[model samples]
Target chain A: MSATRDLVGVAWTGLMARKVRTLLILLGPIIGVASMVGAVGLTESAKGALQVQLATLGTNLIIAQAGGTFGSQNPTLPGDAVRRVDSVSSVTSAAATTNLSGVISVPVQGASTYYEAFPVPVRAADDSLPSVLQVRLIDGRWLDSADRVLHLRSVVLGSGIAKQYGYLPGETRTIRLNNTNFGVVGVLGKVPLDPTLDNAAFVTQWAAQHVFDTNGKPNELYIRTKDGTTAATATVLATAINLGGPDQVSTQVPSNVLAAQAQANKTLQKVALFAGLLVLTVGGLGIANVMSISVIQRSSEIGIRRAVGHSRSKIGAQFLLESLFVGVLGGVLGALIGIAVVYLVSSLEHWVVEIGYGQIPIWMGLALLVSVIAGLYPSIRAARLEPLETLRLG
Target chain B: MSTQDPADPGPSPDPGDPTVQLPTATGLAGPAVQPLLELEGVSRVYGEEVEIYALSDVSLQIMPGEFMSIVGPSGSGKSTMLGLLGVLDLPTSGTVRIAGQDVSALDDPKRSRLRGQSIGFVFQQFHLIPHLSALGNVETALLYRDIRPRERRQRAFEALDQLGLGARADHRPVQMSGGEQQRVALARAIVTEPLMILADEPTGALDSANAAHVLEIFAGLGTPERAVVMVTHDPTVADTALRKVSMRDGRIVADERRVA
Candidate 1:
C-alpha cells in the first residue's frame, strides 16, 4: 500500500507536470458535482419558500375539534385537552388558538383614537410556541403561561396589525368583543407566524374567553415536536391525537408543503443522481483519457519501469490513482462553488432563502466515492498494457 | 597463457580472442563457495503455435565481482537474458539461481523480492523520471523497500558518488546532460546495494567519451561483494569488461575471457 501511495505521488507529479490536461479533467466532475449541489440548494430553497408561504397554512399543526360531536367549524376542544397534548412524548409544545371578532380603539394622532375593524387569532400559548410555528418575534416577548396576570386582552400584534392597532406595548387601549369592554395589556411586536392569522390580536385563551366570554372550548389545538423528531414524532402524535374519537384532530407539517416542494425535489434528486453519476462518468473519462494518453506519452518511461522490475499493477495504479485524485478534487471544488452560487443567487433575489447546511455533508461524501471509481478504469488499462510493445512502439 | 586449463570450471571459450579467464574468481581459490548467479539450460519461448525462442539452452555461472558483458545483435535476445537473470521475467523452462536461491521457482512476489534485494537494473535509455531531481530519482526506488528514507538518502548519495555525480544531485534529468542522466540512472539502480547490476546497453546512447566514463564506473564496481553483467554490441565496449560473452540466434555463440 505504501508502494502504491508512493507511485500515486509520482503519478500526481506527472499529472501536475501537465496542468492543462489536469484542468480539462477537472471540468466535468466540477460541473457535475456543482450542478448536483446547486440542485440540492435550490430544492432546499424552494421548499423553504413554500414554508414561508405556508407558515400561514398552520398545517404541521394538530387541530382539535370537539369530539366529533361538535363537527368541523363549531367543534371546540376543551382547554384542558390542549394542555394534555403539550405533555405528550413527542410534543415539544402546544397552544390553544381562538379567534374573536373585536372592535379596537387605536390612537391616531393627537386628540382622537380610531377604531378600525380587524379580527385576529387569539393564541394562548407557552413561550416555546413562538418558534414552533416558525414565527420570528422581532421585538418584545412571546406569550407565556407564567405571565397570566398581565394576560388580560394583552395583545401581540402581527407586523401589519401592529401598524394599524396604533397601540404600542405598555400603552393602554380598549377593545370590545361580545359588547364587553377590555383593556389592552401588552402589544405584540412584529412577527411572521401565520399571515392569514396575523391581522388578529393575540390574548390569553383565558382573556379571550372573558372578552368573547364563550365556554371553555377552543377552535384549534396547535402542537410542535422537538427538533430532529419532526416527521416521526409529528406522525405518532398526530395519530395519537386523532384517536381522540373520530379523527377530531388532524396533524399537519409545514414540511408537508415543503415535502410537496421536495417531491419536485425528489425528482430533482433523481436528476441529481443521474447528473452526479454522469459528472463522475465524464470525470472518469477525463481521467481515463488523460491516463491513457499518459501511458501513450510515457511509453518509454513505462518501458523503463518494466525493465527495472516494476510490476504491471504498480504501473496501472499510478495512472488510476491520478484520475481518482482529479475526480475528488473536482467534486470538492464543484460542491463549494455550487454552494457559493446558491447563496449568491438566493441573497440576490431577496426571498427568505433557507439553504440548509445539514444536507451538504452526506451528498459531498457520495461524490467522493464516485470519483474513485472513475479513476480506476484507465489505470488498469495502463498497467495491463504489454510493456515490450509499448516501448518498441516508441 | 591463453591455453585452456584441464581442471578449469570456466566454460571453453570460442577460438576468436579466447584469452585467459581471470585468476581472480574469489571463492574458486578455496573450496568452491556458491556462485553469485547461475543459470542452467534456461529456455524461454513466446507463443505456443509458432514459438519465438527469446532465450534457449543458455547456461552461465557468474562468480562474485566478475565484470561480464553479453554482446549480441538487436534480436539476439540479450535483453531477454538480462530479464531472466534479473528475475524480472521467469524462464519458461530451466532454473535461475541467484546467490544460491532458485528464483525461477519462487512466487511472483518472491521473484520481485529477489529482483529487489539481489539485483539492480540500468537500461539503454536513461529512465530517470523527469519529475524527480537526480537524488529524488534514486530515493524513489528505495521507498518501497525495507530502507528508511534517511538511509536511502545516504545510500543514494553514496551511489551517486560512485558514479561521480554527487555534486549534481539536485539537478533534474532534463537539466543534466545525457551522460549525467545515465549516470544518475545508474546511481538509482545500484543504490539498493544489490549483489549484481544487470545493464542493457547502459552506454548505448552516449558518445565514446561518455561511454568510456560509464565503462570505468562499471569496471570500478568489480569487488568480491558484487558483479556487473552488461549487454552491448560494440566490441570495444564489450572488451572493457573483464569477461566477454556473445549470443546469437537465442544461444551463446562465443565465450571469451580477456587477459585484462
Candidate 2:
C-alpha cells in the first residue's frame, strides 16, 4: 500500500476533480457546525455581558420590605431595624425609609390658597440612605447625621419632583410640608433600580418623627453587604429587621435573579447544542450518500487500482481519506462562519464578544469522527468489489 | 481435449522435463530462469445446478524471455486464460503457479501483492485514470510499492520517455489522443518492471498506425528477465509475437513459433 501522505494527495485530487459535487456535499456539515459554534459563542458572549451589568448594578445589595400576612393587617419593621441590621457581620451599610401619613401639596405660584395639584409623597430617609442606595445628586450635598441632630428640616427632592418644581441645590426655594418650611438641600438624579424613588421628596427620619408625627418605624430596609455575601446577608436580614416576628418582613437579593438567568442560559445552550448536533447527523448522512455515489461512479478506477497493486484495505483507505478531507475543510469553513456570526450579532446587540477558540480543535475532531463513521460503508463496499468483475464491467 | 493429446507441440523442450534440469537458461539458475508462469491441468467451472467449464484441463507453461500472444474468437476461454495467467482468478479443479508459488494457496492480500509485484496489465479500452496526468498515471503502479516519491517520479518519467511520450507526460488522459492514452497505459504497465506484461486487446481501440507502434513497443519490451503475453482476437496482431497460441472451444488448437 502507499504511504498515508500519498493517499491523501490522491484523495485530494479526486475531490478536486469534482468540485461542484464536493462543495454541495460540504454544505451540510458546514451549516451544522456553524450553528453549533454560533450558539455556543453567542451564549457565552451574552453571559459575559450580563456579568458586566451585574457587577455595575451591585450584586451585594439586599432589600427587606415589610409585608402583611394573614395574622397582621399591617406589618412594620422594628423602630431600630436599620441599627440592628447595620450590626450584622457582613453588613457594610444600612438605611431605612418610611412615608408620612398624609399627602403634602406644593403651593402653586401666585395663589393664596394651596390647590393640592401636585401631591408628591414625602419619604423619611435615614442619614445613610443616599450612600446605601448609591444614588448621585445632580446639585448640592446629601443629607448627613448633623441635619437630624440640629433638626434643620432639610429636604432632598427626587429627580422627577425637582424637575417639576424647577428646584436646584442651594436655591432660595423653601418647600412647605404640613405647615412647616424646609430648605432644599439636594436634587437627586434618576434611580434605575428603584424608579419609585425618582418621584418622591426625602427628609431625615428624625425630622419626620418630630415634625411630621411619623410612628418612627421603618417600612423598608436597604442593606449593602460585603462582596459575595448577599445571599448570606439576606438569610439573616429579615430576622434582624423584625426580631419579634420575622415573618413580618420579606428579603430579596437581586443577584439571585442573575443566577437564575445564568441557569436559564445554560439550559438554552444545551438545547441549541442538541439541535446543532441533530443537523450535524443529517449532514453526516449527506456525506455518506455522496461517498456512496462516488464509489459507484469510480468503480472502474477502483478496478484499475486493484489490478495495479492496491490491496483492498488500501483502496478503502483512499476513499476514507477523501471523506476526511471533506470533513476537515467543512469544519474550518464552518468555524470561521460561526465566529463571524457571533461577532456580528454581539456588535449589533452591544454585548461583549466571547468566543471559545480553544474548542475549535474539538469541533474539528468531531467532524472527523462523524465523517469517518459516515464513510465506512462506502469504503468497505469499494474494497469488497471483485477486481475481475469490475474490470469486465467497466 | 484429453490431457495426453498428441496434438501438444513438443518442439521446444519443456522446462519441467528432467532432461532440461542442467546448466541452461531453463535449468536451476537459482530459480531465476524458470518458467515465469505455469498452469498445470487448470479448470474453471460455473453454475451449481448445471456445471459449465470455462476451461477444462488446460496445461500451459510461459517461460521467461518469451514474447507470445493468445488469440481466440469470443467464448473460446482466452479471457479466462488471461485471468488465470495474471493470477486474478483461482482455478476450480487444478493449481496455477507463478514464479514457483501456488496461486490458490495464497490469501487475498498475498495474492494481490504477488500480482502487483509480478504481473502488469494493459486493458483494451486504455483505462488510464482521466484526472491524472500521463506521468501521474504511470506513477500509480509504484504507489503501492515501497518506492519514495522522488524515485517514483523519476522512474515514471523514464517509462514515459521509453514510450516516446516524454513530451506529453503532463497531459491528462482526456487531453491526449487515443494513441497517446494507450502509450501512457503501456508506460504504467512497464513502470513497475514486473516479471510479466499481460495486455488484453492492447490496440483494439487504436488506428492502424497506433496499433503498429504499440506492437513495436511490445516487441522491444520482452527481455531475458521478463515475459510479454498479449491476448487479442486479430490474426494480424497475433502474427507480430514470436510465439502464438490459438484457442477454440476452451482448448488450445495450435501453439506455433515463427521462424526468426
Candidate 3:
C-alpha cells in the first residue's frame, strides 16, 4: 500500500547511491544495443546507396563476351550479335565493342610543354554503346550509324583521354590511329561501373573495317533488359547472341552480383541482431547480479523498512523497481549509443544514413524486459529476509 | 545457561508488585477500556527436530500511557518476547492481540498492516537508511498509510523538528553523529504517531551522554493515547521506564511498577 511514487523515489535513490556499480551495469546494454543498431543502420545505409546506384544505372545490364581461354582461338561475337540481342522481347537496348590492336596517341603540337602523354586504348565501339552503357557525353556527339556506314574517320574520347589531348568538342581535334588521323567526335563522362573506359578511345565500325582491316565482329556485347526481366534474359542471352554456339558465349549479369551483395548484407544484419540480443541478455544478467548484491548489502535497510511498516511484498517491489529503473536507463543509453554508432559509421563510409526509427521503442522495451527478468530473484530474496534477523545482522 | 535454568524460580515478584498479579484485561484496565496490547499464554518455539522454547507461556498486558521495559540476560527470551509484543512474529501456542485484533490469526499483509498502523520500532544501531536524508528516513514510517505526499513530508519534517533535528533534516545518516542518528531513528518511529513505540536496546550503541539524551527522549514519548515499550539488558536503561518486566528462562519472573 506504499505510495508508488515513494517506492519509485526509493528505487531511484538506491541506484543513485551506487553510481559506479550502476554505470558498470549500464555498459552491457549500451554496447549490446549500440552494436545491434549500428549493424542494421550500416546495412540499411549501404542498401540505400545501392538502390540509388541501381535506379540510375539500372540493374538489367548484361555483359556477353567470347568464351575462349588464353592461348586459344578466342571465339568472336557474331557481327549481328547486338541486333539479335536487341530483337529479344525482354531486351531494351544492346551495343557491342571490341579492343582494336595498337594504342591511339594524341599527336603533340610543336612547342607544347605538356608532360609525356599516356597512350589510350583504341576500341571499335557501336554507335549505340553510349546509350546502352548509360555513359553520358561530357562534350559533343557520340558516333552515329551514318559514321559507321560511310566509313568516316570519327572517333570518341573518354574524359581522361580528352583531357590528355586538350581536345574540346566541336574543335577539329584529332588523334593518331594506325598512323592516320581520326577526328574526335566527343568525350565521354567517367563511368563508375567501368573505370577502364575512362582512358579508352572509341571508334565506330568504319575505322575498324577500313583502317584496321579487322572484321566488323564485336568481341564483347552489352545488353540491357527491361525491369524485372534481367535474370530471365540472362538465361537466354548467350544463345540469343550466338545461336549456333551458345556455349562459346559467356553472359554475366552485374545485377546478380549486386543482389548477392544485398543478400549477404541481410545475413550480416541478422547475425548483428542476434549478437545484439545476446549482449542484451548478458547485460540483463549483470543487472540481476548487481541487484542480488544490492539485496544482500542492503539487508539492514530492508529490515529497517520492514520495521517501519513495509510489508515483505513491498520490500520486493522496491528492489524490483530499482532494477527496472536501471534497465530503462541502460536501454536509453544503449539506444543513443547505437544511433550514434550508425551515424558515425555511415558518415565514415559516405553512405546515406538510414535508421529504422520505429525499432527504438522495441529495443528499449527489450531492455526493460531484461531488467525485470533479472531483478525477479533478487527482489524475492530481499522480500524473504526475516526482519528481526536482518536487524540483528545489521 | 545456568542463570537461565527454568527450575531456579529466581527473583520472584515482591508482594507489592500489583501489575504482576493483575494479568487479565479486567485487572489491567477499567471495565469500559481495553488494554492496547495483550498476550495470553504466548509461547514461541523454534527447531523442527528438537524444540526450543524462545518464549514460554508468558501473558502480559500493556495499557496506553504506560512506559515499560522488558529486561533479561542473554537467552532469557526478552528479544523473543519483544518480537511477539511487536507482532513481528507469531507465537507457537497462544493469542497475541493488539487493539482488540488477534495478530496471530491474521495473514502476513493484514498483520503487517496492523503492525504498521499500531507500532513503530527503534533499534540500537539507529537503523536510518544511509542513502536517504534524515527527512526521507523519517518519512519511511508514514509510507503505505494513504497519506498525500505533501502531507507526509510535512509530518516527517515536523517529527524531525520535534526531535530537535530540524537543522539536519537534509543530512544523510553518514553525516550525523550517533546521537543525531538515534534521534532521527526516534523521529522515524514517532512520525506516524502509532499506538505504541517499541525500542530494542535503543541506547546500547551510544556513549553515556547520548544514551542519557535518548533515554530522556524515550521517557517523554509515552502519553495517555500511546504506550512505549523498551527492551534492553542494561539495568540503567531499564530503570528509565516507569514499569519494568524482567524475564528468565523464557518466563516473566518479575513485573514491577514504579511511581515517577
List each candidate's DockQ score. 0.20, 0.36, 0.35
Answer with 1 or 2, whichever has the higher TM-score. Answer: 2
Model 2: how far residue B108 lies from native, Å: 1.8
Q: Which prediction has the highest DockQ against the true structure?
A: 2
Candidate 2, residue A87: lDDT:
85
| Cα error of candidate 1 at position A64, Å | 11
Candidate 1 backbone collisions, by pair? A60-A252, A60-A253, A120-A200, A155-A188, A156-A188, A157-A188
TM-score of each: 0.66, 0.84, 0.82
* Candidate 1 segments whose C-alpha is farther than 4 A from its true place: A1-8, A11-15, A46-265, A351-361, A386-394, B1-30
Give the candidates in order of DockQ, highest first. Answer: 2, 3, 1
Error of 2 at A39 (Å): 1.9
Lowest-scoring 10 consecutive residues by lDDT in candidate 2 chain A?
A107-116
Give the per-residue lDDT of model 1 (tens digit) for A1-394: 5565567667777778778878887887788778877877776665566566655644455434344455455565555665667667767667666545343434333222234443344444445545656566655656666455664445565556666756565555665543444455444433333354456556665665555566656666657666566667655654455445454654555445444653436776678768776876676666666666777787776666665556677777677667667766787888898888888877776545555567655556655665567667766766766555544410
Alpha carbon lDDT at B137, candidate 1? 80
What overall lDDT, based on C-alpha atoms, would model 3 receive against the true structure? 0.81
Top candidate by TM-score = 2
